[model samples]
Target: MKHLNIGLFGFGNVGRGLYDVLKRINSDNVTIKRICVRNIEKDRGIKAEFTDNPDDIFNDRDINLVVEVIDDAEAAYDIVKRALKSRIPVVSGNKKMLGHHILELIDLQEQYNTALLYDASACGSIPVIRNLEEYYDNDLLCSVKGILNGSSNFILSKIFNEKMGYKEALKLAQDLGFAESNPTLDIDGWDSLYKLIIITMHAFGVYVAPEQIFTYGISTMNDADIRFAEEKDRRIKLVAHVEKIDDRLIMCVIPQLISRNKYIYSVEDEFNGVVIKGLFYDKQFMFGRGAGGHPTGSAVLSDITACAYNYRYEYKKRNDSVLPRYTTEHTFRVYFRYKSAEQRNLLNFLKVREQYTSDEYNYIVGDVTIANLKAHQEELRTPDCFVAAYPFD
Candidate 1:
C-alpha cells in the first residue's frame, strides 16, 4: 500500500473535524504526520506533533499535503504561499484568504506546478465549484443567486418566527454559536460577498474585487417588514447574486422579498440554496446544510481524496484556462420597502413602477439601469425602509 503524509495548520473547530474524518477513514494509504497550532498546550485530543512554528511543516520533506483551516487572512496567506512554494499541495477552507489572494496563488500554483484545492471555501457541502468546472460545457450561465450566509439566514428566520427585532435575533444567533464573535462580516453581507467572489471566480473565471460589488445586511430589517412579507406570501432573505449581461457582470448582496413560489423562499434557518440558470438547462437548484465543522470538513475531505488520487495517478487539469475579464454594466431590478404611504409616493416620483401598500409598510419595485441609485440612497436607507436590487433578465 502507498502512504501519503499530511500536515495541518490550525486546530480550530473545522480543523479538529478534518482530523476526525481522516482518522475515521484511516487507511494504510495515508497518515497525518504533523499538526500545526498556535498554542500547543490547548487540549486537542489528537496524537500528532503540534508546533507553533510553520517552518516545521515547510521544511518537512516527508509531508506531501497541507490542510489550512486558519481564519486569519494575512497569516494564512503567508503560510499557504510558502506551502505552495515548497511544492506541497494545499487544501484550504479559508474563504477570506482565497477571496483576496486567489489570483496570486493561482499564478504561483502554475509556477510551482502544485494543486491548491479549496472546495470548502464558498458553499460548505454543495459542490457548486466542481460542478461548474466539470459538468457544464458550452453552457452560458446567465445568472447565479442563492441564500449564501447561514448566520444571516438564521437571524432572518428568528425575526420571521419569533417576531423579534434584528438586534435581538442577532444576539440569539451569536448565543447559538451560528455567528462569530465579530459578526460584522456575516451580518454586514461581507461574508456572503466573499463567497460570491469565490463562486464568480469559479463559474465565470473572473476575479472581481470585493469593493466592486454592492452589499447590504439585514440589520435594518424590522418586524413590520417581516410581517408585510408574510402577508404578501413572501419571505425576506439575504441573497447573493451574480449575472452576465452583454459584456458585464452584475452582482449584489442584500435582503430581498422572494415570492413563496421561488424555491429560495422555502430555504430556512442555516440551510442554503443556490439557483443557476443556463442557456441549455432550466434553473438548477442545489440545497443543503451550508455550514458546520463536520459538513465543511466533509468538503475538505473530498478535496483531499481527489488530491490523493491525483498524487497516485495523473489526471488532466479541469478547465485549465486564464481567468476571464468581465465588464459589469448590467441593469438590475430594485425592490424598495418603505415605512409609509408618503415614502412610497416619493419613490414613485423617482420612477418606481410597481407599488404595494400594507398597514405596516409600502414597497416599490423598479428597474435600475445605471448607478443613479446612490442619489436617492440616503432617503431609501432610512431606518423605516429596506432596499434590494437584482440583475434583470
Candidate 2:
C-alpha cells in the first residue's frame, strides 16, 4: 500500500490541527507534501513548504491526497472537484459547500473513480456519517435528532442551565472561540441546516435544500420563553431533525423543547449528541466534543486515515437510478413569540394549545402543520418574532 503523501489546502485552525495530529500519530506513514494558503505572509506556525496556487497540489503526483478547510463555499467545491478529477483522494470539513454541491460531487466520484470522504462536515468528532454509510446502510431509520451546532447549544445551555442572559451566553461562546464574529450562521440555524442536509444524504440518501426544510433559529427567544421551557422540564436546543413520516421525510432545524430525561437534554456547552432511532436499535446516542480545532481536527484525521485505505462512501441507497423526495406534511406543536397581534395572526395553526399574554410581550403554543409554518416562515423570521417547535406527543 502507498503511504499518504498529503497535499493540504488552507492552513487555518483545522488545517494546522491536521498537521499537528499527523505528526503525533502514524507520522512515518503520512506526510504533508504541501500546504496551500491565501495569505502566505501571515505566520502559520509550521515550517512546511507553502504555496498560493491550487495546481501546485493537484498536479503533484506525490500528493495523492487533498484536504480542504477553507471558508469559501464555491471555491472549496472547485478545489475538491479538481482534486477528484486529478484522481486524488480528498477530505474536507466544509459542510456548507458540501451540502450545496454533494449531489454533484457524488456524480464526480462515480465518474472519476476517486474517493472523497468528509467525516468532519457534520457533527464535529461524532462518527455519524461513517456509521450511517457503513452500519445503518440497510436499517430502517425512524428518526435522527440531535444538538448539531455547538455555538447554539452553548448559548442555550447557558440560558437554561446556568440562567445566563442571551447576550451574555452569546458573548461567552464568542470569547471561547465557539462562535464566529458574525454569528448568524450558528445562531440563525444555518450551520445546523447544513449539517442536517449532509446527515440526511448519508442516512436516507435524500437531498433536501435549506429552504425546503423548515429552519428557525434561537435568536427570537426571551426570558419568558426560557421560563416556559423550564416549567415544562425541558431544555431549548437547536435540533437538527429528520423523521420518517409515512413514506416521506420531514426535516427541520429549529430550537425545540426536549425533555430532561432524554440524552440530548444534557448535551450542552459546545458538546454534541445525536439520537438515532431505528426500528431494531431503539434510540442510540452518539456523544462527543463537537466544536473547536481539536475535535474537528480528529474528525478530519479520521477521513484522512480512511483515505490511506482507499475508502470512499459507497452510497448503496443513492445512485444514478433513484432518490426519495422530501415532504413537510407532518404535524408538531410550535411556540411563536411575537410583540404584536399581527405576527400572531399571520401564523396558521391547526389548534392553539396555549396562550400567554403580557404588556411587554406575548407568545402562543399551538399545534401546527409543517406546510403552514413553512408558508409563513418569512413573517415568522422577522426581527420581533421568533418560532420554535416542541416535542409533540
Candidate 3:
C-alpha cells in the first residue's frame, strides 16, 4: 500500500479528534502534513502543526489527501473542488456544502477521476452511506427513517424525560457543547433537513434541495406538548424520514411523537438511530453516538483509511428500473400546539382528530397535507407553539 500524506483543514473539535485518533492508531503509512485553521489565536490543546492559509494545503503536490471539516459551506466546497481537480482524494464532513452542491461535486469527481467520500456528513458514527451503497443497493428499499439531529434530541430528552423547560434544556445543551451559539440550524430543522437531503440521494439516488423537502423542528416546543406526549405515551424526537409513496419519494425532517414501543423512542441525548426498511427484510435498525468529537472523528478516520486504499462511492442505485420523484402531497398525522386561534388557523388540517385547550396552550391532533405542514413550519416554530408528526399508518 502507498503511504498517505494529508493536508487537513480546520483544527477545531472534530479536527483535533481526527488528529488524536490518527495518532492513537499510530499508522506509520499515513501522516498529516499540515493542518489549516482560520484563527491563530485560539489554542487547540494538541501540539500539531498548523497554518492560516488553505491554499497552502491545496496547492501542495506532496499532499495527496485533503480532509476538510470547516463551518463555511462555500469555502469548504472551493477547497474540496480545488483538491479534487488537483487529483487529490478528499474526505470531508461538511454536510451543508454537499447537500447544496452534490450534483456539482459529483461532476467534479467524475471530471477529475478523484475520490470524494463524506460518510461523516450525516450520522457521526453510523456508516449510512457505505451501507446504502453496498448492502441496500438492490434490496428494494421502501423507507428510511430515524433521528438525525443530536442537539435537538438532547434538548428534547431533557424536556420530556426530566420535565425541564425548553429554554432550560437548551441552555444545558449549549453548556454541554451539544448546541451551537446560534442553534437555528439544529433547533429549526435545517441541520436534519440537510442530512435528509444527503440520505435521500444515497438511499434513493435522488438529488433534491433543502427547499424541496418538508422541514420542521422543535424550536417552539412548550410544556403543554410535553404533557401531550406523556398522555399519549410517546417521546418527541427530531426525525428525518423518507418514504416511497407511489412514484413520489416523500422526504422531511421534523419533530415527531414516537410511541414507547418504537425503536427510535429511546434514542436520545446525542445518540442517532436510523431504520432502513426494505421490502424483504422489513426493517434494519442502526444506533450509535451521533455527535461529539470522537464519534465524528471515527467517521472521518474511517473515510481517511478508505481513501488511503482509494475507495469511492459507486452510487449503484442508477441501475434500478424506476427512479423516484420528490413529492409532499401525501397526508399524515400532525399535532400542533398553539397559544392563540390565529396560530392554530395558520395550519391547514385535512381532518381534525382531537382538540384540547387550557389557559396557556391549545393542542390539536389532525391530518394535514405534507405541503401545508411544511408551508407553516416557520409559523409553527414561533413563540408558544409546536408541531410534530405522528405515525400515518
Q: Local error of candidate 3 at 204, Å?
A: 0.4
My TM-score estimates for the predictions, one after another, are 0.85, 0.95, 0.96
lDDT of 2 by residue, 110-159 (tens): 99999999989898899999998888743477788999899889998888
Q: Which candidate is the best by TM-score?
A: 3
Q: Which lDDT value does model 2 have at 161?
A: 72
In model 1, which range of ten residues has the least summed lDDT?
Answer: 311-320
List candidate 1 segments past 4 Å from native: 162-168, 175-177, 311-328, 337-350, 354-365, 373-385, 390-393
TM-score of 3: 0.96
- Tell me the whole-model lDDT of each prediction, alpha carbons only: 0.75, 0.84, 0.84
> Which residue pairs overlap in candidate 1's backbone?
248-327
Predicted candidate 2: what Cα RMSD to the true structure? Answer: 1.8
RMSD of each: 4.1, 1.8, 1.6
